[model samples]
Target: MNGNGTLIHLDNIYTAYEGAAFPVIRGITLSIRAGEYAIVGGPNGAGKTTLLESMNGMLRLTHGSATVCGLDVRRQGCEVRKRVGYVVQSFFFDPLTPFTTEQVVMMGRYGLLGCLRRPGEADYAAVDRAIRLLGLEDLRDRPIGTLSGGQQQKALIAQNLAKEPEILLLDEPFSNLDLCTRDFVSGVLKDLAKKGIAVVMVSHAFDGLPDGEIRIIVMRDGTLSLDETCRPDEVESRVRKASTVQ
Candidate 1:
């Protein structure tokens, strides 16, 4: 992809934990364009999570550079984070914390409103829209801790969308979901991409994607091994290839 007009650009990146013998990610480069839906797949310990973190500036690059939406993620970390909504592999909540589903979803707007400003009527409306969009109305007033795993994931996604971010990053979003919920969430992501939001998802499974323009990135041994446009038979072929390599 063209990095100049891309929403995300990583060039020759290297990242390592302090005092570690080997780098977690080494000399990786990739670009994702606006409105693109891409999936990163690999075996365990392939740096898929690390690459996603670099996109949002959560992990500092030891070398090379990363830019998101034309902003240098390292130099403009806060700004980059504001435009990207990240959903991690696990959703954790304190059992006693009293945040309702609506309240949790409304948190997405905090980045836009900033810490000093309070959520106004418009912000609340946006939260409502996001909740309705994600079909979370029945659970809107429920305590977050009481919801099921799928419901919690939907709430997390709703929270991210409420921010109206330019890009969405999901790491193993379907890991804990049933098949039905996985399909539903996958459709939601496809809808978001159609609305012009760039989406980069990390998944081991790449089945049932919408029939449209999409991209795939394969990661292995802390490097981006393959990046290409998605084709009809691509997923199965990649899966077979990855299986053989392992």
Candidate 2:
């Protein structure tokens, strides 16, 4: 964490995709502290996912600056990624893929283990902890491709947990999950936040929000339109109102 306890700091940042005519997100400034639960919401083309990519240094900054985990995003993107975990909005694994759940989870440690080093006992322990945390113990040996969408989502989340990131950026994590599973995953995220891991998610579903105060950041036209702290029940309405306004 930084000296001020801010894990993510973006100052007037602008990010653009390759060969794009202009930046996808522009003049955006935001900060997130450790243990805070923040939701990013907006209409379909509001650049919510682009914001996540900018936070984790996945996209190049075209202007201004970004710092995550106390490292400069543009200058230290590779290092920044090591301490921040990102779960993308969509992924499809081929059914014929041969990796097991455990193996998939273990892959998260590869960044720390590097190319030549083997996974040590500590690595295995971390993988085990992640699997248990995600309630995937019974399915640890099953092929990842064979699991249901919700199960696969859990495994992917577990994989990121194995990395033990200080910040977790999830883009619509509840998309594949059913009602019960959404609640279950929300509880897990709540626990993670309580343990001091920053959770910033892009989501449309607000029914299963974790208890207590929450932060809502709404975007429109490639920039933040609304940002405030509110109750869980007020999130959807606030976002809806912000999104519909001219």
Q: Best lDDT goes to which candidate?
A: 2
State TM-scores per candidate. 0.93, 0.98
User: So what's the TM-score on candidate 2?
Assistant: 0.98
Per-residue CA lDDT of candidate 1, range 1-246, in tens? 244448998899998777887779999988888888898888788888988988899887889999788899889999888889999987787666699999999889988899899999999988998899889999999999888888898899999989888899999999878898888888899888888789899987677686885688878888877788867357758745763465
lDDT of 2 by residue, 22-62 (tens): 99999999899999999999999899999999988889999
Cα-based lDDT at residue 219, candidate 2: 93
Q: What is the lDDT of residue 128 in candidate 1?
A: 92
